[model samples]
Target: VISSFKIADIGTVDLDTIGTVEAGGMTVEVIDPVADYAELMESLFDFDALRALFKSGFRMRFDAMHAVTGPYAKEILENRLGAPNGTARNFIPLPDFGGHHPDPNLVHAKHLYDEMMGPDAPDFGAASDGDGDRNLIIGKGIFVTPSDSVAMLAANAHLAPGYKAGLKGIARSMPTSGAADRVAEKLGIGIYETPTGWKFFGNLLDADMATICGEESAGTGSNHVREKDGLWAVLLWLNILAARGESAKQIVTEHWAAYGRNYYSRHDYEEVETD
Candidate 1:
């Protein structure tokens, strides 16, 4: 038996199955994974606090890139959290992602980036990848690098009910910047540097040694689940925003002032022939 995930591969499957899909018809038990996931998400934060952010008229724009997270964002951010209608854009999952790649980076999600940088931008803007594990964060006129995001999230995570006790430790992929390391230092918690994969962080998380883990690839999560969760990161950010009563830019600026900022960048090359 083979199990597959992510839109890149899953979209190719023959979804319309006839009765007896395989030898001796397999029983398909349908379940509402979205409701289950939404419940789990709500458990991780102070509901009233997050609702207050929206109640206070702080606008949020989440671009799903027409990928998997559209429904989840719609349910959590709009239905559950009381955000205004149309808060989640490109919210219908399309197999071909409307003829464009569904990566939530500046290159692919450029429309969202442009809107966030525009003069009439919302207070907060975010995007998630097709598979719904990676994310992109932009605030009004500022783009929060994944490296700095991890650090900032780690610093303010306590504002969320799930992490109110504080993080046990922080783990980052090897290529990730040392920004999180500074956060770990200031918090006096353990810091781990592992290879570039979620699997490596799993062990540390299971051991209770690391409460939060992240990669510069825009993946971030906690011990709450094994794999990185994109909406989870978004909700946590909202929880922090609500508790702080500050704009995304203000929080980021203050985080830099407190931790001393780290400037960094990366480049990727494709089709390089190696001997």
Candidate 2:
């Protein structure tokens, strides 16, 4: 397979396999499809257990407001999920994005909502738009609300290792707010609503019924790749904060003290001139 994707060795690693990776001697170049979707996020995210649970007191930020996933969030959150080196802000992929307005909300990523509500912020913060497929969750003073970010990433998608064999049903779109219909009624499964793009969630993700779907505009996703990724909802909320060491404002205040919140509102009519 091109000499197993030719790599004359250099700390070679490929933990689970998604496709294309060869080092020094060449071949790790898929070059597009956003670096082959960052090699399918290094074969569906572990990032060396999120760089060993973020090696010593974590901090994370990702703006990419300059648009188009600013070089795939600086090559997958500071070169494969360790998340350091200026933590990927505005990382530069401008094509008028330099004019700002990449639209990750909180009023156009208000400088990543003022450095994630400041105080040397960064225990997690995010933004994505202008074709990365829209996402905007922030946590160091918290701001989730994309219908509770798909009900807190489908209730922590079993601490994410490609969803750890859970979630076979769950979808939303009809204004998305009952907080993923209370995590599909506490995981009893099957809950669809469909009606806002995502092609009506492609037949409940091709008849598996659903694997997770969302929208309240910020968007969540599933069926692995039918769209609405936005860096796979920030790597499934950083694999549910490295498998629940917790924080993202203590998992949305313990998911609203175990499911007891679902607020909704929206009304826009920008630039109307038909008198």
Candidate 3:
């Protein structure tokens, strides 16, 4: 399991209230995490299949938003998968996120959205939020909503090598749209609806009841890991694109044509006083 500790969160403690122990110095062990994560992601897809996409002059642009995922995206998308040297923009982690919010949404990642919708847009564009667990996916002129992204991933998951045997089931948070339910019904797989939290899907994944899980908040993951992996979602999208040989717009339009479209909208009221 992965864990994190924030030194800044530590509070002052009174020495008089507790006993102190004199101990030897501690030893820290560092591992090659980027290589490990890259290997794990690579294992989930067919190498040649992804290579073919790149070989066909498939252009990809990843905006890391100066978050923790920058190095990982650099290693996986560019170094390992053979994309261009500058395929991953902002591929450097910054303490202050370069004075921008590291949220992978239209409001936060507007630069990427603009470039993707530009005349010389790349074939694919993606961004990952801070801590690397949430993702935003944009294809050429289209911006895929988080709900639609999960649904589309579920429908075409089999094209990827890891999901070739197909998914056991699908799970989504309550706030997410029901687009994936259609997929589960068509595939004859269980569909689980849980409250809005990643922990809600943990049991389903651990029990093998769900192979894919997502939330409406730009998060999607599979049984591959216990937590939502932004890069994993991006790679799966690429795998699906590679196998289907269709543009993102084409795939989305075709999916809507086959599965029917779902309309969903959410509203949030912030800092409202008690009524």
Candidate 4:
């Protein structure tokens, strides 16, 4: 039920008929509809579902990549994810004034990768694809596989300052590694397995039955958002690491030792035509 908005076509509006003073200056015009219609349907930002996130104190940070939905997504995350004012950045249109394709892969997100691996790297770094649905997580010098990433978050959910309230439960996609399952088991909490999609996790989170969920594709979220979140996952990891007083590598290694290793690998097919 998450909704969004876009500021389409900004230009000058001729209001000569309104009889304004003769003074002329560059006037910026924006297109937005206050009412619903067949073509626009009153933009998703005008919905009520977002209020729930605000009520829950979930704040967000994102690596926006020139997508139309970037601004709207930021607004929702800030409103719901408890982001302080003026902290979000839409890293669109790169330094060269050219658009950068926003994909959350090691090679594709070169800028993000460098920043994460650089000397001044933030405690965490996350990014998403063109539409803001997928996610990639990096902690210090380590890049956490989405499967293990979500499991680690679930295992240490109570450590995050925001989630100190407590975690209700955890869930993951059927194809996701069993790391999260072990964490849930150890915590004496329930774990739900759904098909490989964010929609399935949405239903469980909406019901307040689960606190966190993730997929093998690197998407992760909690009760904070009804959709898979990129930056939120990154922040969650940072908060957990900060609270645990351990490096990301240490946390993962310790986790593997306790739950036994679940070595995971993936094979991707590209540029193939359907037979």
Each model's number of backbone clashes?
Answer: 0, 0, 0, 6
Model 4 C-alpha lDDT per residue in residues 13-36, reported as the tens digit of each score: 565344333234434433332111
- Give the alpha-carbon lDDT of every model: 0.88, 0.80, 0.89, 0.64
- Could you tell me the C-alpha RMSD of candidate 3 in Å? 7.1
Clashing pairs in 1: none
Model 2: lDDT of residue 34: 59
* 10 residues in a row with least lDDT, candidate 1: 6-15
Q: List the residue pairs that clash in candidate 3.
A: none
Lowest lDDT sum, 10 consecutive residues, model 4, at 33-42
Tens digits of lDDT, candidate 1, 1-275: 66876433222223454333232234443457778899998889988888887988989899898999999999988898899999999999999998888888888888888999998999999999999999999998999999888899999999988899999999999999999999999999999999998999999999999998999999999999878988888888888888988888999999889888889786756359876
Q: Select the stronger candidate by lDDT from 1 and 4.
A: 1
lDDT of 2 by residue, 155-180 (tens): 77876667777888888888778777
| Model 4 misplaced stretches (Cα beyond 4 Å) | 1-63, 68-90, 93-100, 114-123
lDDT of 1 at 252: 93
Candidate 2 matches the true fold with a TM-score of 0.29
